[model samples]
Target: MTSTDSRTKEDVSSRTKKVPPPMYKVILHNDDYTTMEFVVEILVNVFGKSLEKATQMMLNIHNKGKEICGIYPRQIAETKVETVHNLASNKGFPLKSTMEKE
Candidate 1:
């Protein structure tokens, strides 16, 4: 094979590197109007936390004012935050969620 053809093959392999998606943190913000039980429910339903773990998360929010609920890729984290906000608004609670780069 010609030198140019060999160079082309080598270049193709060098370009094949895969980049991993950046991660993000989904966070919950506490509010007095939102009940502790509701926060636990959100953790269980939205983040797929177990009941026991959900309860612990709820307690954290209660005492900490805010806490990281889950870590996900950027798109997933954004979708999760939007879902939480919509669910909270529909239930008439001032529950807040946000995502930050991890």
Candidate 2:
């Protein structure tokens, strides 16, 4: 093939190659009224953290006001944030969650 044709093929292949999706951090926000036990439960049930790890994360949220629960693709992070809000609200707690690009 001509040099020009080869260069075009290379460009096309590069364009077609899959690149990894951008990631986001799911963060939990602590509130005065949200019990520490509930925070731990959310971490364990929602994020799949072990009880020990969940307890550690809960403490971090308690002390720091917010902490990242996990990193995931943008959509998953957003879904997780929404789920946390829904569950917390349903239970009459003011727990909050948010996502940030990573």
Candidate 3:
């Protein structure tokens, strides 16, 4: 085999290196009209947090005015934010969520 063929094989192997996808954080913002219980429910239903953990997060969101609910890849995080907005809107709450690269 020619040296060029060996170099081509090496290049292909090098290009096969796996890289992890960029992660994003999904955050919930507190609002005066949104109830604490609903925030906890969203945590439990959307982020799959346990009841206890969701309660704790709800407290943080209440006290701090915002909190990160979960870390996920870009598309998943985006979908999660959209879900939160839709759910809140359906329930007549002004709750909001956003995503940021992490």
The per-prediction tally of clashing pairs is 0, 0, 0
Q: What's the CA RMSD of model 3 in angstroms?
A: 2.1
Q: Alpha carbon lDDT of residue 61, candidate 1?
A: 89
lDDT of 1 at 74: 92
**Candidate 2 lDDT over residue span 1-102, tens digit each:** 577656777798998999999999999998999999999999999999999999999999999999999999988998899999999999999999999999
Residue 69, candidate 3: C-alpha displacement in angstroms: 0.7
Candidate 1 C-alpha lDDT tens digits along 1-102: 577556776687778967889999999998989988889989999999999999998898889889999999998999999999899999999999999998
The best-first sequence of candidates by lDDT reads 3, 2, 1
Cα-based lDDT for every prediction:
0.92, 0.94, 0.95
* lDDT-superior candidate, 1 or 2: 2
> What digit string (tens of lDDT, one per residue) describes model 3 on residues 72-98?
999999999999999999999999999
> Could you tell me which 10 consecutive residues in candidate 2 have the lowest summed lDDT?
1-10
Q: Kindly report which residue stretches of model 3 are placed more than 4 angstroms away from their true locations once superposed.
A: 1-5, 8-13
TM agreement with the true structure for every prediction:
0.86, 0.88, 0.89
RMSD of each: 2.4, 2.4, 2.1
